[model samples]
Target: MANGVLRPGAVFAGYRIERVLGVGGMGTVYLAAHPRLPRQIALKLLHQNLTSDDYVRSRFELEAEHAARLEHPNVVAVEDRGRDGGQLWIAMRYVAGIDAEKLLSEGPLEPARAVYIITETAEALDYAHELGVLHRDVKPANILLERRGSNRRERVLLADFGIAKALEETTQLTSSGMMVASLPYAAPEAFDNLDPDPRMDVYALGCTLFRLLTGRQPYPGSTLPQLWYGHAQAPIPQPSAVRDGLPVGFDDVILRALAKKPNDRFRSCGELADAAVAALTPVSQLVVPPEPEPQAAPAPEEPTTVEVRTRPVATTPPPSPKERDARLAIASVTTRLSAVQTRAERLEPAFASLKSEFSAQCSADLISNERISSAEIVEAETILTSAVEALDRGDAERALELTRAVRAHLSTAERNVDAVTGRLALLRAVRANPKAKVAEVRFKVHDAQMLALNHGTADQWQAEFDAQLERIDRIAAELSGRHPDYWAYITGLDDVKSHISALVQRMKRERRLR
Candidate 1:
């Protein structure tokens, strides 16, 4: 239990507290160790004052729920959440990298690297939007830049999932009922307190991009209120104006993002990212050896009809043996890479289909039926999403490998559900046999086990389990004097005892599930 303070070595919600990471107006985050796992996690808990407010408590819990639902390569992953000893906490995957706000303190990032970060972040935002989770807080502090090993790739992630929207709804924050976004990044519509829009995220992303490239805000007012008028009426600044060597074309991407009207901004974060990348580095500059221009027919060779073979045309001799081999090698490598990319593109739809399958599977009550856990499905979905991101990043080979893994995972989950279906059918048959040793033995145990694993045994389910147990015991007593026969193999007293004991044990264990 935490008493307005969590000391080192204290345990909260099954995590061993280590040290405080940071404190904010909302709450404090601590570096904590998993009780059963061998990894550390970031434990974010609401402060006591905030916890006392119903809206704040709901917002904190909603943040955990919505953020946990999103599992993308470029989004921070929330591991778990629950209330503990009157304290609400969210456990998240801990990253060892610094946030963009701190990184920019050194200086503006490389132009290429900055674009990469923005692209990845935009991708993450787009994914969350598809999941119906909006990340309203898009700022430098919320974007973390991680290093991708020797490749030196910048792995950017968007954090704080839906906290901003949750905050926006709080009466404490918006007394006038007008919406408030982070001043520097807030879209014009955001100031009008309009309904939440995805374009708001785009607007903030544009501001973050501005800082990433120029190391300064597009509208550098001193305070949130001071920046409001500028956001609504100020001229959009050009990235080129802030930094040297930037193309005037770059202004197109930034100004459109900072557009005063939400409708006038990029329709989606992906569009914004694509436009920025294109403006910064055109495609013509990337594809080299430009497609060979079609050659005109050599002026018909002056209409020469005479016998002129010309020594086999003296055709450039195939460039020399060494040159031919080198060209062959290069061509072969290019062909292989292209093939991999094609295959990746083909498998992308398969991943999307898997997502639909997962959604339908969960909604169909697989977790309630005890066939598989929600965590299992979430893990599969996460892998599929990561594969999509890999494909987007042009890592075709890796994406293809992950797609295969996702296929295998979904297959295993389907098989598990099928097996459970068969078991459930057999149990149903046994439970329906009124003349047997038990009228409700197998089926009742299955129901109890499922309930215990899921929402636990409520008074209603507990009563049901008890009534079924009583009915079974009465039937067993009634069959005590019967002669031993082949029926012993069907709903026998021993079988009844076995299932009863197992269900009881599960019921006890599930008391600690949350």
Candidate 2:
């Protein structure tokens, strides 16, 4: 279907094409197997009609270069690229599973599975954002699910970069009057031709999560224009309203992410992922959600003490009206001061508890690691301090407002901690195991190398890591190290390290480790 040639078993670039996997609007994807290596790959070739256009060829090359730089478990890996005769082709990892849209069509996934997919995708998006790449078109169709092994279910891999925009690039792929279309997953700003950002990806992710839970797109319409209108004017319906047995906080998280204004949405994909995880967790296990307003019952209608002091009243009234007004003002100020002191007394313990929690949750490595910076911690602390001050001033309403901000910041900090801590623990385990198999050791070493590069300064860290990684490559070059097809797992680590090296360099310069 690609070119009315290159059929199954046909050789292209020394790889035999097995069959056509699928045809998209812009290209045809084929299932290809390498001749010498016992591995299968998906080769995507640009449509023949567009090969002659220099603009299309440039955009295709740009996509391959950008996609090749991304190396995350949740992202589909772009392996190699070349021109096959008149057609341009990109070799990508061939995943034997369905895309997310197809998986959703059968029914809603288990709640835990859905959360896992969403969280993993969020991490991938966070990494991409740090490299200044925005996957402007994020939807179920663009997400591929890869099966690992027997009983391993499937892993989510984000795909499609046809419309992705690189923040550093001045040229755009889409024409001036053309509209870049995605399904219901497009954010409000996406429709307005605004440059996409991390928040825009967060908004699309929210829409995707909503669809996963409810088995329906949030804003379904007959036409793209109709959907755009709905996105602009319609309120996001609660998840529970569409389906029963939804989690309590699910609706709120989705609504917040789908906020009309970019500023109203979560600041980053990590924030959205953290909130989604918390929502999916059982209510009994979660810290209770904060109560915004707590009005005290009308203090039992305190009895009025009406002691009739007739002589005192007459003496006071004899004074000038101006003197009486001044006295009233003084009394008001005294009462306000008393209230402030009382509030301070009540909030002292709460402030202490908050500080203790912050210190206990954020470790030194978390603070120093590139994943979560000191600026985020300072922002959270500042907001929490303001909340305490507000409470001390008897402004409970304003205090509650600041508390919400504090909670959002804390959520992001917790996620960054979790991500970095998990990676650190894995590395430590690998380092401690003297009897670790070569495959396992290689995997750990590769991960460690990536972490080092990602957290390193922008000067020569990449070059240093590259030199160290070459040792692994040299080991694979030995004749005695060759192994059977089944034992070829060790070589896979080399491939992973090569890709991750590129990813680390891209991310470190952009400051998007999280």
Q: Ten residues in a row with the worst lDDT in model 2?
A: 168-177
Best by TM-score: 2
Backbone clash numbers for all candidates listed? 1, 0
lDDT for each candidate structure = 0.62, 0.60
TM-score of each: 0.53, 0.55
Question: Where in model 1 is the C-alpha error above 4 Å?
Answer: 1-5, 171-181, 282-514
Superposition error at 274 for model 1 (Å): 0.7
* Candidate 1 global lDDT: 0.62
What tens digits encode model 1's per-residue C-alpha lDDT throughout 1-514? 4456789999888899999987765578899999999999889886665455554555566556757778899988999887776677788888777889899999998878888889999999987765546687799888887766876776788877865654543444543223233667777776665555578899999999899998998887755567777888778887876897664446657866887877566667887787677666543343222222444434334546685443322322234343322222222222323322333343334333323532233223333423242334455567756755664454656655664465344434433443334333333343354343242244335434444444434663566566656756665555445432223334455456565656555554565464
**Worst ten in a row by lDDT for model 1:** 324-333
lDDT of 2 by residue, 141-260 (tens): 778888788988678888865334421121222321122436477787766555345788898999988888888888979566777777777988777668877764676578778888
How many angstroms is residue 93 displaced in model 1 relative to the true structure, after the best TM-score fit? 0.7
